[model samples]
Target: MRNIPTRHTAGRTIGGAVAALSLITLTACGGDSGSESTGAAEKLGENEGEVSILAWPGYVEDGSTDPEVDWVSGFEKETGCQVTSKVYGTSDEAFNLAKSGEYDVVAASGDLTLRMIAAGQAAEVNTDLIPNYEGIYDFLKDREWNTVDEKNYGIPHGYGANLLMYNTKDVTPAPTSWKAVFEDAPKHKGQVTAYDSPIYIADAAVYLMAHQPDLGIENPYSLDEKQLAAAVDLLKAQRTSVGEYWSDYTKTQASFETGDTVVGTTWQVIANLIDPKKAPVEAILPSEGATGWNDTWMISSKSKSPNCAYAWLNHISDPEVNAQATEYFGEAPNSDKACEFASEGHCETFHAGDEEYAKKIWFWNTPINDCLDGRTDVECTDYQDWTKAWAEIKG
Candidate 1:
């Protein structure tokens, strides 16, 4: 979700954890070790005096937005390393920026983390260097997007789901499935909305997996040409009723307020921001489930201040620190300990630690020709295919 201003970029260089275990798919393509190496540090050393970071706007706040929203100051004070940071609006933007090797670390969404690893822009993180690592959620550890070839590349930060949000007054009978926005979308006619990104195609694939089981779509991110075409067809139909596609959180909330959009997909953060007294809207995870995000904090392979970078990683993963970060960013924290640090009801509201709820979410991962689900019988379409298909659906 675009919770902050468009092009909201900033920087902090600091010195940074070990934390816990989780079971999940490993989605990154670990190119051979022979792939270009930016010099992954063999061991941690003295604070390098400074560290640089690239992240989503709200992910790296130093109290600039609100004085109380500062996580960076404490890290700098404890490590004696100054912090500098740059924030990006989208995963694609973050991926490109990381490639420049200008930052020591990055908070990458699942969609970009694996791609960065495959491109060798990020390196395998030495988990032993992070003492706070033991605090992370077991389900998030060694996941496909954050680990490659059984090697951990980064730490699982926080996560949230894309929910089906609707104006309670207008969307009758309370929608329970994705069909409300797909097959039955016309009933809302010109009032439906959706996320404006190529990754959204996975949402359509998700719907097909349930409504048309014959498609044999096990993983929404792993789609062959035939399956992809089917998903694109469904989205193309949805395009007709889409009043507007959105990435900006404020714009989406505004649309709901004005009743320009009655039903569509949304982030939990957006749902929280909308004044229910005025908009009377509610968000739900439809029966077909939803596409979500599991962001990771990865160190750059070419980091000039590797020690400081590791320092920052460890600092952020601390239970108190992780709580502050996830709360500000509007997602469930990675550590069970973070739950104690959160405000009353915050953890329950986001379904924190609910393994069953997590199982329902198809976290975002970049599509690749080699099926991510381990199906060797067919070559699935890659991210480039999704991009092209998105354009056609939009047109």
Candidate 2:
């Protein structure tokens, strides 16, 4: 649902050229990169030129040789466009570098998509160039942040839950709520780890949405003054249980494997990483529906090889590519077709393709006034308040 922190925590996303995974298409213009019409079709031809991509670790890396994952070659072969990527450690990193217009495209998160579009850091995508976008779920179609006035900027990628994972062999009566790592976490002590970001404030906010209805909280990110205070106070109260705030996926896996932690927030991929036989780990949705995020692929307004980028976008959406991404990346494919080719035990074992199951689960969308519950009157507290509250909660 969020990012797996890497070197990008250093503040910039543009790094060395390493081959990695590819991404998707677009919609509206929130801000102007040029005076071009958002509706105009920009042909991304395979000029056999080069394009740069700013993305996450596993998206393009194949783990074949040096950097571990090697997906860049396939994209190059298929499109004849050379790809060079800077694998980001955090969304903030990509957002910053992308703002410079130095790179072509980015794998943006829901939280930053709007910020990027507003800043004119990314280009509004022409859906006509990327036909596969039509397959994206309507839920992601056009929204306030990624799209402005019905125009799109990002191609819907994939997503999974930020679950409470545990060492199944050791933990019994499996913990079901965020409380296992927050409220009742004292017993776990050194074994507990939490997400190392202000964004995690949303976890507490979501919990409040489910348990503290009297608080009158709606969107976890859209906290009013009183609502923000409550979320911060709840986290500050639960701070003692937070032993570590994890930012790296490899380290997170190590924490569980070493039995250093019994329960904490983690992505679904972490569950698959735990040895099913040795140390069993499970992704608990919790009794209350959980908060999560979807990874989206958005085109760069300045991409020289925009055509090749669009090709990669559609390629990843294909059922086979989507299935491959799931097996290797450890997240569910957003495309319905991709879920059809879910890896072994993925569909039956995890309901990987169950539309009914997905509906029952709340996918994280960027918080906006067309509130998740659909009340248009409430105003979400600005981001500054969220920041101040995050510091107080984690302090």
Candidate 3:
């Protein structure tokens, strides 16, 4: 049976105050702010009998939330690793919690993975020890966010796109592009919604990359001042039409149901939750492509249960387990095999294992002064800039 629709908060923005403080701290100490952790394990040892996990809500279910929704119990029963899991509301919170060295493992979104690695919170993951890792999609392996300098840092979990969701009865001709929310937003004035976060700036950047080739925007997350300004302009214009900018899933669902929102950016899970009888809606990955997130399960650098951590990683990656966890959280499973174990039509709904579709997504990444797109000549805007810009755009 499908689990209840719980909002999965992985890639949402870190609060402005927290972001400003983090940026100041990173700058004061330079980018290399934390000690590097020891390398990946060369061999496994006996189970440590316990493991603590920091993860997004619903990612590490032990039936505490709902008796029928759980995958952790089996892992504990089989591996003898009593699981204690904490759910984090955002990547920044996960980063702070993981740094406490209180977690043996962390399910990190791309935006938080590199930060964790930089802060000495993530240990290199030895995929050889995770046999199920071989089954994960190739496109997900060694990505910029989860890997640094060709060394893996974590196992791929699941992913989902920030899709364009619109009221079917209200939207005409079946919108296939993000233009509906950008240039055409005025048509749905006072009814269009958008994600409320700085990372969402990347969505505008993605739209710009396709419509304005002269911007030379190779990566949405790596925008220079001019490119960022162009995106900011687009967003500022869009803000005029936006009914509400949302970080809460239930609010978006309710808005759509009540006809307060006719068109806007949304997640597939929210689309699933809307009562079709109240408001007909459809969510699609627009033709211009989209921004999304791929979360990873990383072993903690200061893990007190390294053996159990490895066991938990491998256990969770098993196709059936991965399916249960990802489906519950409403995202594409990481591997083709995992799709088979997912509920009927779930894989198709999320486009699991579709490498071509995956290519169109620029997964969430922490914007830094050093361009993620590899342009050394010009400095790109960092998360701090994005944070400040987001406030300006929203205002």
Candidate 4:
């Protein structure tokens, strides 16, 4: 989510095929922080030759005139590697593109990372190659989505929560529950919008998990027929109140600008940076508790240039790189040193260096039920099953 796309807010950049919009909310303002000292970045080693990257649109600076906000040139300059980038709207698209064996690395979200690893499209990361990797937090290092056993697959990236952001000017008291976009949305009638991605079906799943705890909806990704039915039912009700499904940042920003929807579930990064010239909106972390996500760099297992890829990962997650990403993306940095280079107030505003808040954030861990915590009876749903439930909800 953070800067990786959608800042994990409502799975904004998960790809239109999977969710709704292609969110690139990871700019300095896209999150809570903006600029930092890459002086240390100069110390990180260089990348050799050209590294092809399949990236989400806003992951790196796009040669925009805004030098104040650029990651590519700096990266290339620091690494000494030439760069060629192709932008895709969804993880599915990136996966398909990456599957072609064209790129060296991918900035994958939790939902898609495991699939990439399983397919052997991404190689397991050798921590020895990435000296800075030791800085990654322990919990993230071995998770259902990234690693198997003690092996690592990719580097820690950015993370953020899916908050219930809305046009407070229109929503009156504002919303405190997922029901605002589920069962209760109808009262608002044509003023509701849910995430526009297939994986977003998980948002509905998360709601059911909290509100219908009895369902034992432990893992949104792994739903049984009964749990799937409930999630779909809730979504169908939400769809009725929905005016439109959004998967593009420009579209959501525009929708809010036109006052098409008063309130809806959204990402913090996108919600915070909505083009104010277009609309006045506010983001709220609702009380029923909310679901969130994270984005990370998953290396291609078959990458011809694992060296360059590792180099890229090391450079990106370096404290300075991580800090820059956090400031621009408005999410928490996964790097310990990166926070030191972050803007003065960024630690508070974006949770940049706050371990306490970081602990509280339910960064979207790819849902698995073996139980991921340890259980004999439940196994998580595979992508195909989640895919099916997603389609049913859309229907």
User: Which candidate number has the best TM-score?
Assistant: 1
Give the candidates in order of lDDT, highest first.
Answer: 3, 1, 4, 2
Q: Identify the candidate with maximal lDDT.
A: 3
lDDT of 2 by residue, 1-395 (tens): 52213212211111100000001111122233443232324675544466677876777654454453445677677767677778776665676677566666678776667556554565667777776777766654554335554567777777666788887766667777777766777778778787766667778877888788998864565566677788888878777776677778778888788778778888877777776665678877776556566667776665556666677677666666666665576776666666667666664544554554454344443333223333346645544455566677777
Better model by TM-score: candidate 1 vs candidate 4? 1
lDDT of each structure?
0.80, 0.62, 0.82, 0.63
For 124-220, candidate 1 gives per-residue lDDT tens digits of 8888889999878887887767766567889989998999999989999899999999988999999999998889999999899888999998778
Candidate 3 lDDT by residue in tens digits, 137-255: 88778766777666788999999999999999999989999999998999989999998878889999999988999999877877999999999999999999999988778899999
Residues 75-184 of candidate 4: C-alpha lDDT, one tens digit per residue: 77776777777777666566667767778889887766755654556666767777888887665565545654445667777777777867767676667777777877
The alpha-carbon deviation from the true structure for residue 118 of candidate 1, after best TM-score superposition, in angstroms, is: 0.8
Which stretches of model 3 miss by more than 4 angstroms? 1-32
- Per-candidate count of clashing residue pairs (backbone under 3 Å): 33, 18, 0, 32
Estimate the TM-score for candidate 4: 0.82
Candidates 2 and 4 compared by lDDT, better number = 4
